[model samples]
Target: MQFNPVTFAIPVFVALIVAELLWARRRQPRAYESRDTATSLAIGLGSTVAGGLTAAAVLAMLVWAHSATPLSIGWAWWAWPLCFVLDDLAYYTFHRSAHRVRWFWASHVNHHSSQHYNLSTALRQSWTGFFAASFIFRLPLAFAGFEPGMILACGGFNLIYQFWIHTESIKRMPHWFEAVMNTPSHHRVHHAVNARYLDRNYAGTFIIWDKLFGTFAAEDDADQIRYGIVHQIGSFNPLKVVFHEWLAIARDVWRAPWRHKLSYLWREPGWSHDGSRETSDMIRRRWNAAATDQKD
Candidate 1:
């Protein structure tokens, strides 16, 4: 309930953007990123404003209806802590679903479309991603008696905390810290294009969630990661960026055999028996490989 949409999200969001541009300039003042900054910013800014207003309206109405005559909005206060756990758990489900569901991946892939992994690239968020995974995970909050306010606070906190881990500046952490939380090291692997690094380290806050769920992959300093997706999305148009994947999914689904409908939702991205194996099975065969193997 303490989460004000603007107060919680805007500050960190602004700070991250400012920091990224500063870091990029300091690293090399003349090196302009090939990606379109103006278009990316437009998409990011537009999505944030539209999504925030729509989400706020939905939540406000939901909370009001639940807080009828006898109850007050403050009733949501008691559920704040549970909101954190529920939101994180829901986020895990949300992420996992985004990967498993082909239709959803189209909306979700915008985050991975860039060939370079930088702060500006992080802002290349999808404009229409939530539609793919929002339904299944959000209903639990309502069922658990969490008014809209509490749910919003928990969701906002997870997102705000995750912003800083998107960079390449920070490297490995001290033993215990890396064990429990998501660091740049872990997130780097998540953004990696090398087959071994794809789709791992999906945690938002506590890296332990990935550890417990068996999705964590330690950084490998030896084989430097190549950032971006297999087929880079070439356009800078925000409209194209948002809907491109959805279009791919529709084409794929139309061409897919009827028996494979369910499998389409579970198969790995870019997977088609008709295609190539980008990452060999042996590369990701183990989870806790020695640090020596991880040196990139």
Candidate 2:
């Protein structure tokens, strides 16, 4: 029998909950001003647990379906290390696509909802992920002759590696290790909303994917990172978290042309007007400028 992820992963779950509680206690003063941070977290966590377990059940079915046959296409259990890398390649594609599509981004936007970045924030995964991230793309792996169990296991493996990097500690890895794999340093950049840090470094285990694909960006010490999106939802409410961007998407779709409507679902999140009106950067700045001008 293979190692059960729920069994092995218990330590991670327990540790995160304990650590986040301690962190919450320490930051109670700041959290009050942030207004109901605990409430948002409670709802968000419930949704995340429900959503994650639901997804796991769905993934398990695929694994069981392809496990018995002599027709498994992926490498053997011994060769799963390579399959891990392949799994990450597909992950990168799914991630990039998720950001590109508004509907997909709606489910994913929750992970980035927090203005604060920490382990708990990482666990603040969206519940509606099933609607956006189906097993459609990964099915290709099954068809390519790879065993579903191997592929699904690799998916879990990728997610496990990705979890610890959600910390503020462990700033960097060794020079050699940092050169190849995704370190916390790279992940910190991914969480930043700073103009330069918006969408860089999407690799799970290998930084090589980002380097090869031109999405890599080195972290800077001089400029402190401001975490979260340009437009902060400022709530831990799971319903709001999952539907906030979706609401924005619906508004954009209402007035948009047929071509624009379709593109909003298929193109990048900030894509607008055939590159005519404004960039996401420009829109954020303009909104801020207008707010400032009103204040003055």
Candidate 3:
């Protein structure tokens, strides 16, 4: 077993969740729904098992890729920060694709299934990420000469950084900090199902990626945020929460015409061959148009 920061942070993660639970009881009772919290924790546990099962193969591939590289970052201290930033960029790419691309979204949707925004929602990780081949997103760093272990460690820290931002408890960070880093405010926008927020704020550690890529949507204090997917999966059952999107994708692929079959797999969620459903772009357009009409 390698030195995974996430594993070491597990105790602290539990402590914070307990602290948040106590806070929620007094400040916002609705923030901690018992069933939702349990489901999220179970899914998170299953994800760890799933990741453990596939870690060896994934690490072997990264090691091979790194060995083949002409350049080697080797164990330089300066390399850690560079690797961490690059890894975060890779995460931003993966996180954005996990929303824009249905195949990836099928694996990532469980994280956003909970309607409540709390520490527990952070634990709703994906059990199918390895199967989704999400590790490919970070393979570029390995090929670019960073050690596989360093890349994985940086990724662990990135995951840890994101866990605390998954709450409604913190409204906003300072303006300067909010501008650069991924805060609870920025993350809340990412989790929001609102028309304006859909497919926005994909940064994992730094918010700069979203700003640079035009995917940034600030958390609007005036407009109440609604969490979860556009089409709600109204079940707290861990199995349903984790696999519903995947099952839907399978059903869609099976039912679609041969010509459009692949589209169902790769297209953004809500995409239908006959235009029966709406993608985020389509939903946003509709919402914008309605807003325009009401103003007129």
Candidate 4:
């Protein structure tokens, strides 16, 4: 059986969420909305169930891939840390692709749907990740000789490390820690719908990956951060939150010309056949241009 640290951390996750709720009450009431929290929890539960159903198949594939490879890193103590760091890098790659590629983004967008950023919002996971083939990202580790179980355990720890950072409770960490790790401040920029912050800070555990890869964007206190997608679904319905993007993709593909149909599935989010919509990059360009004009 694949060892998943997230399974053991469920109780701790609950306690921390409750503590965050109380803190929100005393500090930031808007941080926790009733319906939004319920929807996020419901989606998270479904995502867990979805992942459970697919876990065995994913592990089996990883094992098969590992068997095909001649290299074996084995279960050495050093392998554990090495596997974790590599797994985090894999997450960074998957995450960056998930934003840049619409098919992957459809599965990832649910995690960013909530307008609120709190511990509970961290629970907002995607139910269709398996359908989107996100597990493909970790397959490289299997091919590289890391054991499938070790890769999973490391990925679980990565998830756990990310949970607390999805909040407004703590503004920033120590300068050194913030520079090295993915903190609330950095992650907030990731989740923000602000044009300046769009498609940035995709680090899973270590902020170093984003820093190295040039995807890092620091949080600016002067500009208020608005959470959620560019086109807000404007609903608390969990099913809508989970399937809206997929449905949109289907509709866009069906309606587009045959030559452009596949583009709808693979192109960046907000791409349009007729230049009718704006992707994050387009939005950022416009914002920058307007700012430059105003300064002139």
Candidate 5:
């Protein structure tokens, strides 16, 4: 069994979620809804079971890639920090693609399915992430000579860093920290379904990547954040939450012309051959145009 920091952090995760629940009840009674939290936790448990079943095969591929590469970067003191930065970049790339590509979004949409932003929302992971092959983004680090174990450690730590940022509790950090780190405020924008925030802030641990890529969007106080996908799901069933988008994709692809079948799978979410739907970029542009007209 590999040493997974996220596995060890499970107890800590539970403790914080309980503490948050107590705090929410006293401070904001509506912050934690019974059905919503249960749904998030259920989806999270399903993700864990799915991850466990697929971990061995994922690890095998990483090990094979590392062995085939001639570069042998050992675990030196500096190597750890280097791996962390590199892995964070990998995460940003994979996370951005997951939002843009329909095939990947089918697995990722569940995480944003929750309307309430709280600690438990962080655990609402994807049940089909292993099959999505997003982990292929990290293979480059292995081939670059970073040890497989080291890469995994950095990846785990990256995930742990993101867990605390899923809350609505901490409004914002100091300007300096908020400028670099992926704080709760930035993450709120990422989870938002609001037009201006739809496809922005795709960072995992560091906000720098989003800033550099022009994808960062600060949370706006004037326009409050609305979490979840653009088209919300009504069901709290774990199976429904995890696979709804995928089922939708299957139906859409099945009905499309053969020439357009691949487009249905690879195009952005909300894409349509008949121009009836809108992608994130299209949504944001329309919002921006409306704002401009108002200003004019």
Candidate 6:
């Protein structure tokens, strides 16, 4: 039997979420809404269902790729650490692409749809992520001779590490930890829809990737972080939240001219055929300009 770390972590995840819920009720009742929490849990259930349905095929592909590859970097003691780092790098690449590319963003947008930042919000995952082929990002590890099981285990640990960061309950961490790891503070900035925070802090387990790639932005105390996507979804219905962006993408691509259809699918979330929509870069520039004007 294959060991599934995420499945084993489910009880721990539930316990922590319950603890957070109790903490929020006592300290910050406004941090969570009943409907939003239910929606998040529903979406999470759907993601697990979708993931299980696709697991066989995904594993098959990885196995085939691993067999075909010439190199066999076996399960040495050091290989585990190496796999963890490489898998995290793969996550950073896929995650950044999910934000930048519309097709992937259609699946990913649901994860960011919740306005409330809580432990439940981490469970609000994408039902269509399997279809989005985001797993392809980690395929290189398999082809490079890393065992698929090791890669998957590292990926699970990466996700488990991220779950705690979704909460607003914990504030900043120690300076050394904050500097090196993806703490709650850094992740809050990532989830913020604020123009300045948009598309920044794309890290998985380590903060070093964001700093090295010029995507790191410190959380600002002056500007409050607003959670959710740029255009918020009004409904708490899981179905609507899961497929809204996909529907929007379909609509945009259907109406777009032939020459621009590919761009509509591949470009950033806010990109449009005309200059009417604003990408994250454009939004940030406008925000910066307005700030400059205010100072002047």
In candidate 2, stretches whose alpha carbon ends up further than 4 angstroms from where it belongs are 1-8, 20-44, 47-49, 52-57, 60-71, 274-296
Angstrom error of the Cα, residue 292, model 4: value is: 0.9
Residues 250-275, model 3: lDDT tens digits = 89889988999999888888899999
For residues 185-264, could you state the per-residue lDDT of candidate 1 as single tens digits? 88888878676776788887778788888887888888798876667777877787777867866776788788865555
Instruction: Report the error of model 3 at residue 180, Å.
Output: 0.3
Clashes of 1: 7
- How much lDDT does each candidate structure score? 0.67, 0.70, 0.92, 0.93, 0.93, 0.91
Candidate 5 accuracy as TM-score: 0.99
Output the better candidate (1/6) by TM-score: 6
What shift in Å separates residue 49 of candidate 1 from its native position after superposition?
Answer: 3.8
lDDT of 5 by residue, 131-159 (tens): 88877999999999999889998999999
Query: Which residue pairs does candidate 3 place in steric collision?
Result: none
Q: Write the residue-wise lDDT of candidate 2 on 1-296 in tens digits.
A: 43435446647765874675576567642322233345445645666476567766656656755564456655656658767878888888777666556667777777777776555565665677666655555766665567666777788778777777766656788999888998889888988887667677888889889999988988999868887776778666667876788788788789798867877666667777667644455665776788789999
> Which model, 1 or 3, shows the larger lDDT?
3
What are the TM-scores, per candidate, against the unseen true structure?
0.79, 0.79, 0.99, 0.99, 0.99, 0.98
Q: In candidate 2, residue 102 scores what lDDT?
A: 64
Q: What does candidate 5 score in Cα RMSD to the true structure?
A: 0.8
